[model samples]
Target: MPAADWWRSAVIYQVYPRSFLDSNGDGVGDLPGITAKLDYIASLGVDIVWISPFFTSPMKDFGYDVADYCDVDPLFGTLADFDALVARAHALGLKIMIDQVLSHSADNHPWFVESRASRDNPKSDWYVWAAQQADGTPPNNWLSVFGGSAWQWDARRGQYYLHNFLTSQPDLNFHQPAVQQAHLDNLRFWLERGVDGFRLDACNFHFHDRELRNNPPAALRDSTMVSSVNPYGMQAHIHDKTQPENVAFLRRIRVLLDEYQAIAIGEIGADDSLAVMGEYTTGGDKLHMAYSFNLLTSEFSAAHIRTQVEQFEARVADGWASWSVGNHDSVRVMTRWGGATPSPELAKVVLAMQLALKGTPCLYQGDELALTEADLPFEALQDPYGITFWPEFKGRDGCRTPMPWQGASAHAGFSSATPWLPVPPEHAARAVDQQAAADSPLSFARNILAWRRGVAQLGQGDIVFFDAPEPVLAFRRDLAGAPSLLAAFNLGGAALQFDWPQAAGATPLDGHGLPGAAEGAGVSLPAYGGWFALV
Candidate 1:
């Protein structure tokens, strides 16, 4: 692959800034802490390091609510600290990508403050503001993902403003060309800082229907399709988000990125995610790639995985995709898919399956150590979403806990001082120091990642899923001029046997370090096992 096409099949490691490492003894991870750990990140064999939002914010929704676009938050560190971190990551051959939350800004932002001062202010149209109906209700029936009505009434302007998340996060008005230009200038600010790319947060929510039309009710509701805890998914979401005008704004963003040879991956959360992903990334003039919450759901089965990948492939033409099973928002894959207890075999199988699939793979931090969600009490939770809907939903704090580096140290060596969130004992048992031992999941992940780096067919190939039994998933990856590779996995906990006539004359690839996998004329796989061979 050409140097310019690096992100096509690159393995990007996500670094949630608050939990990665704490170097300032402030019980929170900072930019300098990440700079100090570049060597360990490089050891994972990933091509890029995508850091979650660390921009200036009020911590309402962590760093997602941006108070300032051009500067770093004092809690995270100074702009100089960010520059040093980027310098160190580049020195270690790891490209850096920052999170860009372009959809909204914190209410405390200067623009929002000025916009709300009065309806006739210079920045009055900078945000989504509307007049109430005769009944004194909001303009529409839009709902916030965090909960309740999406509109918030502001007496200063005598109008309600839209907030798809917390009321503190006011949705920006993309209809205004000045708003779009200002955001593009912010992107240039980062590009000038030598950043390689950006992970667009809520990319589909950038625009809303100018008519302020109410979203139609959804026909059905399922936990797999949308969040069961929040009512935001109960709507068809036609007018509130994923507007047609978003494409033009994306093209403008692409033009700016092209000047710096940078790339962008969008996060699409909508009623029809696969179709939106196809539209957002097609024609190579919008986002370089896009990923949705399809694979992040709790559905873990051979048939489910096959359907998701195949449906995307069928719809997407000339567009690219970036796949991830876990990230900062969703529950960790181990507990969500691997059951309540941690399974080393299950972890290894999932790692291999994600890497073998076509597209760039993003591995969340501490997933290589097979970390599970931390069960936190209601009082211990910090997330506003969790606090709003407790007992039924505990929020994202479970997966956002500090990364455990040392098993025998206080707070799992995340910080000597009291950490923001308590480190679970179960997580400490699977710490980096403990998993460095031979045959551990950490060791298996290291071997699999290194092995994937050598196989072009696994990363940069077209995937075709073969018809296999319920418990087994088999796929063939074919790359131009490269030997095709066949990969199979047993997703169930019971031993399974699969008959594959295509395995004739195929050579088994060893040293992948996957456990309980054996192949012969056909194949024999133990519980939670995998097999890879050159066909």
Candidate 2:
């Protein structure tokens, strides 16, 4: 692969900084913790390590609400710690990608502080501020993704400021040229720090309609269709996000990335995410790759996966996609897709399916261990979203628990001090040390990733779905002048048999570590099983 195209078929591992490891015994993971584990990350055969935000913050929304865009938080470490991390990761042949939360900043951010100070301030226009209606209501029908109205009354400015997420995270006014320039300058600061790329958080929320038109009511309220916990999805979201000006801003971001030979993958959350993803990346002057919430939902059927991938392929002809099944914000794939009790067989199948697809794959930390979502009592829950919703929604704390590195050690070797979130007892037995055994899922995951790297057809090939019965997801991956590979999986809980005519001349590829049996006539997959063949 060309240097500029390294991300095209890359397998990127997402390291949620706070849960990865703790080096300072502060009960929270930090930059030095990540640096200490660089070799382990590289051993997974991933090309990039996408570290979640560690910037200075009030921790209201963790590091997403950045108080200082250009500095590392003292909680994580200082600037020197970050530089050491970059140096160590590069030494191990791993590219470092940091999260850039450009959509909003912590209310304590100097820009937000000054902008909210007074209407006449020079930075007053840097944030999205609007006046209330005669009735004292918000200017429009915009709703926050967290809960309630998106507008918050700022007494200092005597106006309502927009916050797409938490009220403490005030939205930036990208409509203002100065705001856009300042954000670009922030990116330039990181580029000068030798970062390889950026994971653009909430990339679509950069611009809202200047008119602040009322969003029309949504026609449906399906959880699978939109976020289930919050009513933010109850509106059409037409005016509040996915604005046309976002494309031009992405072009500006792309130009800056090009100057440093870096790459960017955008996180797009929208009502029509596929369409927005196509628009954001189709021109190549926008995001290098973009991923939506299509695969992060509760749906686990083969048909759903096929539709998401096919729709993206159709809509974004020239665009690219980066696929993920689990992240910091969602429940673990094992508990969501698999049963309450995590199954190693099911985990293997899911990993195979994600890697076999025709896009860049992202592996969340602890996913290789087949870790299930930690079951925490209400008092143990620290996520504000869950605390607010309580029983109806558990929030993201289940997925953000500390990683288990040693099964027998206290706190699972995550920290000497008490961990911010207790490590689940179920995950302790599946720690890195235990999973290093030959037959463990962690070993299987490493083998699968290494095998994927060797097969150019699997990594960079075009994907074509086969006409298989329900519960059976069969696809053929083909590249010009390379041997095509046939990959199939049983996503359901029952045994399945399928006659794949296209695999007539194919031979089973060993060392894939997937369960099931393959024969000359056809292949039989057990519950949550997979089969791969080189044709």
Candidate 3:
């Protein structure tokens, strides 16, 4: 793939920095720790490595609250450590995409501190500040994604400020020209430092309603982005976010990225995320691609998966999508999609299905081992989101637990010291060292990825889904002047025998190691099995 369009169908491996590895035994993963694993990441045959935020922050919302956009947090190491990481990743032919949380900054950041200092300060309008209502209530009915009211009263300003998340992470005022320019400069800083691109966090939240209109009650609750228990889902979120002004700002970001030949994939959460995704990426003057929580939710079925892709394709003109089955924010796919008794076979099937889709595929860390979500005691929980929601909604700590490298080592070889989060013994059982067998999910992931490289249609072709039964997902990848590729996945546990008329007379393709066979129009698939052929 050419460097310019390399990200078009690239497979991205997300490395949550805090749990990837601990180099100096600090009980936390760092830049150097990631640097030490570049060769391993390259071995997966993935094209990009997206590292979550490690910026200067107090870690209130972990690293999402940025205090210094231009510096690495001491917990992760210094600027030199980041430079070395970039060098190592580039040497391994892997592009580095760091998280850019421009929508908000830590309240302690110099800009936010100064902005909240006094109403007459030079930076007073840098953040979203609003006046209190006549009855001493908040300006509007917008609620925080974390919980409670989105407005927090600032004593110094005698007014309220908007925070779509935690109060400490105050939303920036994109209406301010200076704020826009400042973020652009920050992007330039990293691009100059040899970083490949960025994963724009909450990209749609960059702009909000200027009039401060009250958001109406949601016609239907939206649990895709937040827990159903969260009141954040109760509102339609029309005025508070997904503003029209965000498009121009995205255009500016694209212009900046073009100058450096860098790419950007945005994270979108909205009332209509699919539509917003299409709007932002269609013109090609905005984000290169975008992903929503539609596939990341607890809903798992052949219909659910097919609908998301079809809906996104319908809305986009020429936009692309980065479909991910797992990420840091949600329960592990093996647990969420899999039943009480999850199977490694399901993990292999999920990987095959995600790769076969007509878009970029993003794989989360430790998922190759088919690691299930870790169950942590409430007292041991560190995530504030989970703590607030309590037993009803256990936060993301389950998925953010330390990666298990060795089954027999301390903390599963993730750290010499005690890890920030305890590694589950169940996860240790499926650690990288233990899953070295050819039949392991890790080995299957490698084989499938290597096989995908040789199939041009899988990488760059139009997708068409066949109407099959509930447990079976059948699709064909069509490329001009070449035989079409037919793929069918059995998402259920029971072995199945189905007839796919479209797959008649298709030639079976090998190299991808999965147990499935087809005879004319009849296909036989084992539990969580997949079949591939050239039709």
Q: Which one wins on TM-score?
A: 3
What does the lDDT read for residue 296 in candidate 1?
92
Report RMSD (Å) for each prediction in the order shown: 1.2, 1.2, 0.9
TM-score of each model, in listed order: 0.98, 0.98, 0.99
Please, what are the lDDT tens digits per residue for candidate 3 over residues 33-81?
9999888889889999999999999999899999999999999999999
- For model 2 the local lDDT of residue 83 reads 94
Candidate 2, residues 1-535: lDDT per residue as tens digits?
A: 5667778878999999999999999999999999999999999999999999999999999999999999999999999999999999999999889999999999999999899989989999999999999999889889988889999998887799999989999999998899999999999999999999999999999999999999998887536433576787678888998999999999999999999999999998888888988898887799999898889998888999999998998887778899899999999999999878767777888999999998899889999999999989999988888887778888899999999999999999999999999999989999999886777889989899998888888778888898788888899998999888889999888898888777677888878887777765688899988988888
Pairwise lDDT winner, candidates 1 and 3: 3
Over 379-434, each residue of candidate 1 has an lDDT whose tens digit, in order, gives 88999988888878888999999999999999998998988899999889888889
**176: Cα error in model 1, Å:** 0.3
Better of 2 and 3 by lDDT: 3
lDDT of 1: 0.89
TM-score between model 2 and native = 0.98
